[model samples]
Target chain A: MSMVSLTVNSRPLRADVEPRTNLADFLRDSHDLTGTHLGCEHGVCGACTVIVDGEPVRSCITYAVACENAQVTTIEGLNDDEVAGELRAAFTREHGLQCGYCTPGMIVSARDVVLRMPDASEHEIRVAMSGNLCRCTGYVGIVRAIRSVIVERKARGAAPRADLRTALGPVGSGHAGAFAGGADKTADAPPARIASPVSRAATPRETAKLDADFVPQTSFPQSFVVAHPVDVVWDFFGRVDEVAACLPGASLVGTPTPEHVEGQIRVKVGPMVAEFQGVADISRDDARHAGRISGSGRDTRSNSATRGLIGYTLTPVEDGRATRVDVSIGYTLTGMLAQFGRSGLVQDIAGRLVSAFVQNLEARLGQGEGAPAAPVVTELNAGSLVYSVIVSRLKELWRKIAG
Target chain B: MKPVRFDYERPVEIGAALALMQDEGRVVKIIAGGQSLGPMLNMRLVQPELLVDITAIPALKRIEDTGSDLIVGACVTHADFEDRRVPDVTAGALAGVARGIAYRAVRNRGTVGGSLTHADPSADWISILSAVGARVILRSASGVREVAVEDYMLGALAADLNPGELLEAVRIPKCSASARWGYFKSCRKTGEFAHAIGAVLVDPDRGVFRAVMGATETRPILVIDRAALFGASGFSTGAAEEVAQAAGMGDLLDRRTHAVALRRAFEQADAA
Candidate 1:
């Protein structure tokens, strides 16, 4: 049980209620504010809607303990509120309600729509009403009622109230960034950053966006110097069978086709290691001496996703046997790979990978006669790539922190 | 049905809330908006011994506008966001998504932190914010940590939040001029959960292009900048199905539904 105090319907109310008691039950059982009804008792039906600190909230879903030291308004409070009173009259005049089960929530929601969305369109009204399901009435009359309220409010030249509670004072203000004492491990750090609202333009496209499940596709460019002639290096990478072998943490599964190779690439970052089955569609343009390997795969166990568009162009150097290989890689990675795919970390790892591959290539090409020696660098494994890079990044960040 | 008997605590500050949740050594659940938890409570899906109400904590409700990132408090309601009372760097995309959550009543109480912490893969915040590269600030007894929104959800109703860790705020980057986005959600009708969700965000300047599919009832699957580099016309009907099958959706119906949703999303992005 919890001792709770809150201002309800312009009166101070105190109660010893169960911690899980919802605001709707608290209002109805203790204060007899049955006007704030309950329907589904979950969140779907808005029958138990009430204004907590001027915002319409589903009392059925809101806990009574959470409302301590706050202002609450039930349907009974509408008798005194000018905007709600006007809305009640409009609802009655337009037959906006049916069996009245959803009326309380509808009316509370209507007050919010009228007060906050002063210039709501018909579509906006429908959207606002969508959250509060009214099974009895088809919502045609409800829309009409809210629309009338909008028009009336607009004609009167009324601005929306900036504060949640018109009767009570505001609830809280900003605080010091740090906690009261140096009690926990976080005490050594600076205080939390302060949050103050910043004005934004009406156009949405120009502002900040927060979206879900939007894994962005990104491309990175890598350039490395190879210690061999452009033609020699180009020919070396031109062969499909040899080119696929250079990939880190890779093993070809079957006989290679002219344009296809099936393999698995393992990503091991310390304790986290994931193996993804990948199929690369190998292609090369003889005229341009450029290669493009477009491939995608997923690790079923980790539920991680990987897609890569790797294209390389070998340009001749001004002098000597050195050739500059420009690698432009575009990839979309989700789940595990994405977890470590920070830009700085990725770039550093990629640079090291190219360095390792080029060193291996230089070793194999050093053989003047017979087949090239098996140029295997054990640390070049993808697991080591992900692990070493992540560890180094963490160490670098830790260094900056210590500094 | 009412929830089983539980103790409750409402702390006015973040530190107090953290200490209570951590040091109390009892089964505690943090309730921000209560919109989602309320439904689960009635169905008896979960009942903790203590409910730590973080709504009154002033810090969690603050909206700080840094020059580049918009720091939104965890308790900022969808209604507050929908009404444009907070800073949105994603243009009006945040408000637009907020206005459509469940209902005006639900939005009024449902919060960004609660939504993200709840971690529904099909949730607009999970897909949209993750696509836009938002990070969630988590406060715990140890300290504060920031996690990319895209990497937060592990599976349905699963998140990376550790015990004693509470989601504090969300940091979103301001939309740049080159950013173009499209989101398509197919719900049975209004207010119902989505059947299939496709969200794409393209920013040529930052080299970010992603197409994400949600509402699969698990984790979201994404296709990177290829969607933007290739353009919408690049996807034939066969290509869309291939991309869906590649993501490894569990069932045939899901593959088809996700494919149609992704195509619609690409078409919308192209039109935009």
Candidate 2:
């Protein structure tokens, strides 16, 4: 056994824990903090919700020794907060409880939601509370209770007592009392009113501001500058063999056309190998007066389909020494990919593919000879001039060596 | 259900932690947040003879933002990333994924380095750190060595961390201003282990993108590109099918689910 010191809900606790003791077990079994329940012994269930340093997490899945010197908060600690009280009241008034097994976890989770999202909507609240499951099928009422608090708080310009009571119901209301039963019994004390208003539920504006703090922004315009004539760059880009060489783990097959290009692309990524037939539309961007490519294809291996549009604009820079290239791509998912919508995983894969393409192009261009040391300008170029020069030189050398 | 008996140590410093690890050798396990390892212990998946608790090592808890990179100690919990005091690039992604880690209690007890060391394929940090091109700092009796995040992850529940070595901190380069990044995961539920995860960063100005996909396998699948060929039909078809084949989705228990995940990954990559 080892002795470790830590703070739990503002109280200092010193306990002798075994090396294998989990933090959730220590809290529930040793300290008797039953407010933190165990749903999945694994990390899945949000049932064992507890605030560790202000963030909520599963207690059942945490090891006790890992929390040495940490500040921990269970459902017991939230009793003193006005927002928790309001959520409790709203839960009761809205009949957010049934058999009540999941209530403690729900309350702890709800406390986090209220603190983070005072003005959360019914849908946002539902999404935020999705981690906590209620077998009693009381999610509708639970959502209403949470949303009611938000509506009430927003109307009053502060934490409103009426909203809290209306959303949760008055203290001692049947449903509210039942959910509070375990907490009250564990504390062995009567519920007391909190005098501070500063601790009121976070309003919608506050939650929105908070949401804005973390939401990723998409602000960059997709554009690049290449130093070659538009015709030369376009010719190289139009060649399937040359394009294939510039793509990692890719091989191109078949012929090209003005409206569409058809071929087989064998691409290997990590442990997976995909062999698929692809077709794309090549067109002229009339508005931006650039080259526009758009089309859709399918992966025969997974039977997944992909669709996208790419716009490219080329401009002369420093004579014919360099050309600025701009590329923009808009892609959509269908078939199997649609299942992963809104999960955030799709965004990650898209980013990787784009990055790899860029790196491959850079490497391929770096290998070309007499690629201008300085930037160049060319009105007729399709790609970067320096890159085109290198490619052209390499082709010439290959031809001379073969001859 | 109580935990089985085992030896424990509270190391006051990094040297003490390393010394204890050296003495105990493989018999000892180092604990940080205890989020992932704790459940393993409770399940008896790992029964170490001695546990060296490095929480008392103050040096392992610091987050230093140097001009070029951000250095984070091993003992730094996900909550530490939520502190406004931390840098925006590090904090934003950390908080975003950390918030999805089970719930509040787990995040409280979980440490940043611990999750990476555990190398759970479904873990958020694995994919995120891998995509960002972070570096892991390891300390042993011999000295300290650094490994790139991509090189550190060996496989499922496997890492390049050697014996008698303890992870001290992680360093991540500051993202370029033109970088547009995104992270996505598919799980049975919001807080559950991810079925698949992808992390991506795109530099539109530089015409480059970097991506790492995790959970479909033990280590992350890395890809880099400049030509934006993925947006082309042929490349998209080839890449999507390739991902499916690489993941062995057809033989998977839930082939449909896996296929969906792979397709989504491809679409997401194109979108990014």
Candidate 3:
């Protein structure tokens, strides 16, 4: 726990809170200020909007410990405010709310819109209030209420509060002293609990969605040439264990047969990491030097699941001295991670993954016959891949700049 | 969603923050505005052992206008830019871009260095700063180094940061009076992460006409060739397509959307 001192609704309050306790939870749980709603704990939903140091902020994402010595005004604090009074009257007259769940946050955000952009147009008001979502009224009534407040306040000669831009950095920042370290005693604390594994019963749809011959939502092709012959590469692919070892962040959960294997692949993209655990069905054809692997996996932490199909063929290249491997991957991802989908980002990460796999595969193949496979990588460090890719990309960019 | 329990430290000095980063055994992350890291932490996307809050660092909170360049501290908020708390060295270009980032509520806390270091490909600062010819000042306990904005972000969520180093400030070359800048981003909704971003800065006095095609899932495609889009005729879509194609964008529709964005930004610049 950390000690945080702040003035809440004109009252000087100090509390000891966990570093992870966001301001909304700090207010609701500790101070019993339940007016700030939490719709999406991520910053996407503005239901937890509150006033901190005279600027609106998302309390759900902003930790209370970070707001030391700052002033916080929840919806309850704004009861005596002039703008809130007008907005309250307008909202009631316009039927701006029905369920009243988003009222507190809506009022807070709407007050800012009125203060900042007093002369804003209707379209501008909609754009300004886009962060705050009101499920009821289709936002027509909410827009009307805000617009009415702006017009009425303008007629009353209330100038916009252009003076609120006082702080230099983030709101509620710069009010605290240097680090005294965490106030919580660490010697007697217990070990943190391990996260519980995701239950399969929770997501039957993920398993049901994985079927043979099912078309993938998105597919991309990648080809790489290695300094090995086709027959040698083909033999390596046949050994599912060796192949799995070649792929970074992939490890077998159990002993695998020629036709079936169970594995987990941990994929990291930027800050997000997902470890997908599932089984795969593998098939190969000797004549065509081609094979296919289909599987589905789910990451328990993010509750994101993916169904993927990988098809590859090995062809002799460079006068049979080397091998050219052509790979086509199709996948459909769903759930929380997929909701922030950037297929281009996935492709970029996949390209790096394949490059890493090929490098590992080359190293394994050069080990000669009956050699033990290289140590399996438990996690794919995308940061290292990004670094390697950047070095070359930088040279090209500099060259372009020179020209 | 809530973040995993972690120790927090609010360092008041840059040296102290840099020292905290030297603890190699612990995964320590430097947090400025918490606008970008906040959401990630709430979702447990990044679970660091210790969070070194650099917001209270006095040096990083200061912004300086050096006649020819604007030295903006890493902790200066987007609202600081949007509200002109920091001087507009780019002839309102920086303010215009700052206003469109996330929203007013978020802008109140999101910082320039935070957004750049976070290095989301779709983020506005990377594209605009790169176009306006900005360089970031990186500091570590060892020493300090300067890197061009184009070289700052290696890939998505990847900044070219050495261990124990923190971005101190961004040194943006003040645009000449004759400079014309335009930036446009396409999003499904207002204030969302952009799908396609196009920013162009043509400063004949400064001998710089740069075009950037951002939100490409990696380092943005920087078109340095002036004739690729900014010809004697001002702006051309044919050149935008050629530049996009040369960047190896194979998707026809994707290339077209980016080209259109570039063209729109170009037109916006041309008008300015």
Candidate 4:
């Protein structure tokens, strides 16, 4: 019903499209760009891969309306690029594909890997291509094809590939930072200064060296500081029943105590109920002017080892009108629980647990009689900022490395 | 594979887009990146009466990063995030999940606000934004209202956004130097819908931590609390199960295949 003009693979074309018309559909249906296929119509399969403005994405899941004035490239567009040619040759020479159903996506995804990761390893190649599924080739040939390109490129004295290792550094690493100039103005700012000088350098070689020197072997402490007076906060945190009651799905399985208490707690997650028996260790730090509490327990029903520790430090600020609390925790997992673990899933569940605990603590502290009325300031330190930047960068680098 | 016969409108501004939506009502569906919605239409899954294309709206395409937060327009695509042209928080989060969203071409056309509004539990934005405590700004003829990511998603493909309301932008709180954040997803293959997604943001100094899990259900499951509890013995089975149960996340096996993933996330946060 409407006329729209857009560019595809550097060519401007006009089309009459419905509002619901997807760009991928337009290309395949109207423009005859069949190189981009459709699989998992819900946006999971990489069969419909394309390059728009130098980044690769799933064309199948993208709408034509969203790309009114954007540049787009299908597999057809790669006909002229040397990197694409090399990848094609490598795939053929290495037998990188089998059915070829996923070839277009494989090649497009590999193109990104090669461009971003000039110095990738075999392991890195596998990780990068992990996103694109090839049911037939068993990934052996695909990995070899990509690795061959990197090896050949390196042999020619080309720049090192942007492997996941280098991408894991701080925001300003040599390779990752190269693209920093292209980042939006907001993301271009320098990272906050942390107390420690943790190097944010890119490159697996550099990361390996840094890890060797500072592995962060020391576990997170079980004590922390709250922004309120130690005695006042202690009176609230010391009660086991109150702590259990404050938790969303926590139910005390035993008695309360002043110094230490042991209890069993049941948490219902979906259809399963996981229970843990834990003991709290409470103490005071006079030198640093803080209070601490540590709890350790395991899921007896699931027969999994799950441990937790909490520490708090309270600092009076603004003429005692408000208090600042520094809390730290260290947890561990072992036994049956260790087998099913992956990076992202663990982070999500852990993040939710922590958030719930904080909200509960805040609500409790806010409700108590005669509680101080002050803004609770949550500050991120320099060390943490550096870690976030490095972790984020590394994740990107990993994708390129895997591809 | 092309879309069925339907009307199309490309409004130069938001007002024109809104007027078209008002006239067409339920018959119209707005398109941004078309990353998710595009494929559905191609497959004939959704047939709308009218198509109100907003890609030409210049204001909706800008990504603004204020010191305290990052404001992403509705038309910002996944390609934009992959290009590192957005804030680190936005780019990093998108990059982590981009590889799994199909292929390079889809990313180029996918928009952040579009994904969030679509409210697909398996979609990347649902979990990432919820985990990061991002807010969605909804615009309607009546006015505008801001809803937290955690509250906006009511269920799978179900959101609090009304039919006439448009998702204008997403606001992500600026991360601090000391905050520790991580995002993870589990799927059968790369560029696949997540069987489970976990996102964590921890501020150790302030004793605050937020953990969100999406794709396990219709909406993202959020938990906000003190980070220290993760280190306690109670964290693994006690607090973990409690938090999971409260959020109606179901059983470990049903929601996520592995128990180790749950434990690892807890351990990582405890260490942070």
Q: Estimate the Cα RMSD of every predicted model relative to the unseen true structure.
A: 16.8, 20.9, 3.3, 20.2
- Candidate 3 stretches greater than 4 Å from native: A183-210, A370-379, A382-384, A387-403, B230-234
Docking class of 1: incorrect
TM-score of each: 0.63, 0.58, 0.93, 0.58
CA lDDT of A383 in candidate 3?
54
lDDT of 2 at B187: 77
Worst 10 residues of 1 chain B by lDDT: B224-233
Per-residue alpha-carbon lDDT of candidate 4 for residues A1-403, written as tens digits (9 for 90 to 100): 3454567778987786544455577888888888887765555557776775556766655555445565677898889978899999999998888778899988988988887877778877776677677788898998988888888887887664343221110111011001011111133332222112123112111100111122221233222224455455656655666666555456554466655666655543211234555666567656665555566566543455555555667666656654555556545555433322222334333333444445556666777765532322122111221233235433443343233
* Model 2 agreement with the true structure over A145-182: per-residue lDDT tens digits: 88887787788787423322111100111110000001
- Per-residue lDDT of B114 in model 2: 86
Cα displacement (angstroms), candidate 2, residue B58, comes to: 2.5
Which pairs clash inside model 3?
none
**Candidate 1 vs candidate 3, lDDT winner:** 3
DockQ for every prediction shown: 0.13, 0.09, 0.58, 0.09
Q: Where is model 4 more than 4 Å wrong at Cα?
A: A1-45, A57-70, A98-101, A130-135, A159-403, B24-26, B89-103, B205-207, B227-231, B249-252, B255-262, B270-272
Better of 3 and 4 by TM-score: 3
In candidate 3, what are the lDDT values of residues A114-211, reduced to their tens digit?
A: 99888989999999989988888899999999999999989989978966666699998888787557734466653142353444333442333447
Q: How high a TM-score does candidate 3 get?
A: 0.93
